[model samples]
Target: MITRKRGAYTGRNKSSAYKDLVWTVATTKDTTLPLETQIQETLQIIDDNLKELHSNKHQIVSAQVYLANIKDKPVMDEIWKKWIGDNPDHWPQRACLGVDLEGDVLIEISVTAVADL
Candidate 1:
């Protein structure tokens, strides 16, 4: 029953935040790359954060993906499916939406996962 917080922010200061068994992460894609590459890059960021929390994709309980354009869903989905692999049982509940992300970021992802004990 440990609580950890990563990327916490207070008046311009930032750090990671976690609580109990769950860890959370939020990231945006590098718009300089193609949509597919952005998806890959975003997923990599998620993977890295999960690793830091002693978890992996399999432990993700839920996720929210934001796209600059809703039409990009299909392509993003394709990359997401590949990144998560073929294990349906390991999949998390997810949602995607169109948003106005900051900078040149075309995609953004936020995830919540259970940490490994």
Candidate 2:
């Protein structure tokens, strides 16, 4: 069976899970914010989404970061490193890509993790 968690954004599921894997994605609601703030907000949402799925950042196996500007990657990397932190167990195999996002969205992140069964 597949489980989908509802969210306030566009009638879409904030995260969806099948068996033991959960896929989640997030971006800041306030798209007008600067890159740093957007990233911060998006990560915070992902943190909550994971917890709701009985998972956490440490359980993330993969992450894909979408950026409106490729030049912002360095800054995004710094914030990401700080949040994911020093533990190897907390690090995910992540990739960042430059993409044209809707509106003023500076960054968006999608992750896949192992959720509690």
Candidate 3:
């Protein structure tokens, strides 16, 4: 079975979690900020979306984070540590990669999770 949870954002909720899937994407970017600032902001957005999914029956199974610069990994890791510390149990398969960003954005993530049957 599948279902869509709705809340608030612009047009639709920021996240979508199905009975057997967890769909999460980072919120809009802070274009004027530095790379580190953007990365932290993006992580916070991910956290909020993940928390909403946790309120339902699904659990995060994996996360793929993208960065605009590989050299910024250290800074990104620092923020990631703090975020993960808050909800240790929700840890999922994770990976980070360096790639060309869409625009002024420095970070983005796509997460997958599973809802209990």
Candidate 4:
């Protein structure tokens, strides 16, 4: 089994490592945006990171989403459904929770997926 990591950085240092699969955790940078937009952007980031690992939404095994406000769950759900598309079999096990996010970040998403390789 192989593993990969991306966007893993601390302070001013950076690293580039690739393996069989990748697990990524990302948060929205713009909390001022509407919940829907934030969710959409977060999903886009997930998609991009998965692509780097030769994977996609279909390969996702699990996902965790953090929200600044629980009231926005419905809105986030709508966007999440559309983002994952129509493949029910490809949907990952997911959970959402309310949390105190830093800065303007209104939403955060983390996912684990298998690589096509």
lDDT values for all models: 0.76, 0.94, 0.70, 0.77
As for TM-score, the candidate ahead, 1 or 3, is 1
Clashes of 1: 11
Quick one: ranking by lDDT, best first? 2, 4, 1, 3
Best-fitting candidate, scored by TM-score: 2
* Cα misplacement distance, residue 5 of candidate 3 (Å): 6.6
Ranking by TM-score: 2, 4, 1, 3
In order of appearance, the predictions have TM-scores of: 0.82, 0.95, 0.72, 0.83
Where model 3 places Cα greater than 4 Å from the true spot, the runs are: 4-14, 54-59, 86-89, 114-117
| Winner by lDDT between candidate 4 and candidate 3 | 4
Query: Looking at model 1, which ten-residue stretch has the lowest summed lDDT?
Result: 11-20
Better of 1 and 3 by lDDT: 1
Predicted structure 2, TM vs. truth: 0.95
Superposed Cα RMSD, model 3: 4.0
Candidate 2 residue 89 C-alpha distance from true site, Å: 2.4
Error of 3 at 101 (Å): 1.4
Error of 3 at 82 (Å): 0.9
Clashes of 3: 0
The digit string of per-residue lDDT tens for model 1 on 87-117 reads 8999999999999987878887888787776
Best by lDDT: 2
